[model samples]
Target: MTFPAFVDLLRQLYVNVAEHEFALPDKQQTDSRVSLLTGVHRKEVSRLRGAGAPVRVVPDSVSRTSAIVARWLADPQFVDARGTPLPLARTSEAGEPSFAGLVESVTRDLRPRAVLDDWLDRKLVEIDDEDRIVLMEGAMVPRGDGEVRLYYFARNLGDHAAASVENVLADAPPFLERAVHYDGLSEELARSLEAYSREIAVETLLRLNKYANQAIQNDPGGSSRWNWGVYILTSDATSLVAEETPENKNAGGETA
Candidate 1:
């Protein structure tokens, strides 16, 4: 972010905290109190206060598309024996696992053709030689637009930061936030390990996704919400290297 944008965000955050976390006995959120706590001027606080709380609403298109794709990827009828998504016909008149049925199973509000058209425009899906609709690889991962990608970026990073921060501040760590870091590995070995991790991560995600898909269908009116995500990063170590250990120095003593 540019320095000005960052400052604006920080200022807004401070104002929110002051109003919600440090309210007076009369329940008034005073600008003077916010200015004192956040080092923002009282006048700036008053100006921002008029904007109300920060908006956290997810776009309808993003939420609905994500749900539909999740079900497509996870629902047993939509996948083959090897768990790959099966190419679907346009409607149930063609057969089971038709694209129209797949969409209606999620929500009757959106027409299957509309979703298909959007997906085609976004390159999220393609038509096969037989005229079946086939999901494109990496379709689940957001791409092509800064707005969509940035939404996921903010959500995943924000949740991770929230968990890590809660763990540090709480007397007992209530969140799961753990990682293993090893240095001094040859680039080849590091890449191999990363591949293995990716393999395992995908398997875990698919398993949980299937379970969650069934769960939401069973409890469609449920009020609670949850999120699960995985990430990996690799970079050159700037600090002094330690001796590489092991009987089998390979990734977990195995390969991907």
Candidate 2:
């Protein structure tokens, strides 16, 4: 948290960019470029790059299976009367929606059955007696897959921070930074809010995932990356704290 420590972290980040970011596609990762991009001194960039320092390995892509499960939790068409995700049939029946349909809605390019198999193998979902596919908890959290979790842990946190900064700096229509705060609440209510937040956040992210995937599909070679985030916080010991509900938690889904 100190300035000196922060500077060291920045230097390490510069080394990371120098060593990896341009090594493949650009292959023009000069010390000056790293210095300019990272705001580290040219000499330090060279030193860090030449020292063979162990740079942090950042994960590049999020798990597609996890994204699918998140969508299932968030999408209303995929849920039942109780507001829990319905155990969907593998294949559609008479125009009714199925698990395959749910996956396809988010990612048309990925084969639905392949996605299903991956989810089942990962234990993110389970098949029931009627062959219905039921979604399970921790869809967004990687289980036993340390590498995948690492990738998302870095990528999502980075983007989420970037979005918040952008919103603060923007002149008009801030980039979707909103919340609600309450000062006094019992532990039971706080716990209820936590679970409630997860349900709503999942649904909102799923909606965003669906549209973003579609945009990516439409423009396969787009250079820029797009992302959105949802998170919740609560008081630790009946103290004053703020809570923000990005959207109203509806019975079927969210309305942001």
Candidate 3:
């Protein structure tokens, strides 16, 4: 995260783009091409050339856990009429939407009992008075694990930044990035607006997550990845973070 590290990462990306997107049939000349395009030293480009693009490390179980959690939030079998997840009995024989049934619906390789134990340890779920498994709010997202949090931080921020860059550079299709920024607010008004913004934001995200969860059940896995994210900000600073303008034009995305 130091300047030098960032530079190195950018340099690597440039080389990857040049090699993969702008490759010459003459393989030995790739370093020179990358150097010309990125203004990196040819020697440095040569050293970095053909190094595979850096990939973020993801924990092995995140995808499966996320899928199960999403389904629990979405699938009617697991949620009540109001779309809230229901407390599940321990096994399928006990009733529908039991923890055992939910796990097997996602995957049979991992035992339901084992997953339940892990979730309990992680504080993602708890057994209530009736001894039914109940999901904690915001349990679908991995926040406590620092590594998982960092991976998501990079993915969300990186994609938003990329979209903004593409727009500034006028690269083909533009991405959707919009916000409403206002000033001259009293603390009370700002806090009220912030509260309203968060309520609407959480609702929007949960609705979309549910829709996506149901929609993807029949899907054969595809290469394209998709995400929708939102943020809300209310700052007490006397001045705008960037130079003031009539309209909100800075690229940072927000819901309010």
Candidate 4:
């Protein structure tokens, strides 16, 4: 952020924090009270009061819908021997888990019908003639929804950066943060590798997700949030170049 913009943001933040933190239980939120608490000038506080609150874009944690879908894709009870998600009855039978079971496993506090309706509305799952629900997509990548796409963009990127930072700042054994890079590849080779890597990454993530869920269930300690992701970017060689002229010398200090 530019100097002026950052200063403005800090002022806004002070006002917001003061307004919330110093709020009187029996009385209204007063600018004078906020000014005294936050050390912001009363006039500035009054001016910023008309301004909006500080913007906060935190990573989205796993929702009930996402948890159910992850279990559907990972849990053995929800899949066949071939490792495919089975078309499941709404309710379980004879100790077997079903679609409703999946939802309940994630959250018993919520009504299973609400989850089912949400998935149906999002077109993430389908209903069969017997009222069984079938998985239409393997992953919970949102589609045809601009707002949801933006939400995922913030959530996924924020978590990814946080994980990387955590690994880097670790005192003991750090979590894994590894990547492979290659350049000067033929277009055909690049395409083939991209496809192969995608299949391997997807399968590995699904397998790990299954194991993680089981581990969470078995752990005696309370639960914590965890997430990992795989991504790939491929670009041609020309995108890296900068035009060289008399004003800017080439790599060897020779003008081009």
Candidate with maximal lDDT: 1
Query: lDDT of candidate 4?
Result: 0.70
Superior by lDDT: candidate 2 or candidate 3: 3
Candidate 3 lDDT, 51-141, residue by residue in tens: 5543233455666788789889888899998888999999876466699999999898899999999899888999999999999984866
Give the per-residue lDDT of model 4 (tens digit) for 103-212: 88888788888877877887888998977898886236666665455456544555555556566667752656666665556788778878998889878987887788
Colliding pairs, model 1: none
Put down candidate 2 lDDT per residue, 85-194, tens digits, no spaces.
78899889998779889878767878888877877787878889988888877565676676675455555555555556566667864567667655345778878988
- Model 4: ten consecutive residues of lowest lDDT: 247-256
Q: Pick the candidate with the highest TM-score.
A: 1
Q: Please give the range of 10 consecutive residues that has the lowest summed lDDT in model 2.
A: 247-256
Model 1 poorest 10 in a row by lDDT? 247-256
Clash list (residue pairs), candidate 2: 74-203, 179-244, 180-243, 180-244, 181-243
Give the candidates in order of TM-score, highest first.
1, 3, 4, 2
Off by over 4 Å in 4: 1-62, 93-96, 128-131, 145-148, 163-175, 221-224, 242-256
lDDT of 4 at 222: 58
Give the clashing residue pairs of candidate 3, or none.
Answer: none
Residue 256 displacement (Å), model 4: 34
When sorted by lDDT, best at the front, the candidate numbers are: 1, 3, 4, 2
lDDT of 1 at 97: 73
Query: How well is each residue in 81-166 modelled by candidate 1, as lDDT tens digits?
Result: 87788999998764677999999998999989999999999888999999999998768778785556656765565566657756
| Candidate 3 global TM-score | 0.74
Clashes of each: 0, 5, 0, 0
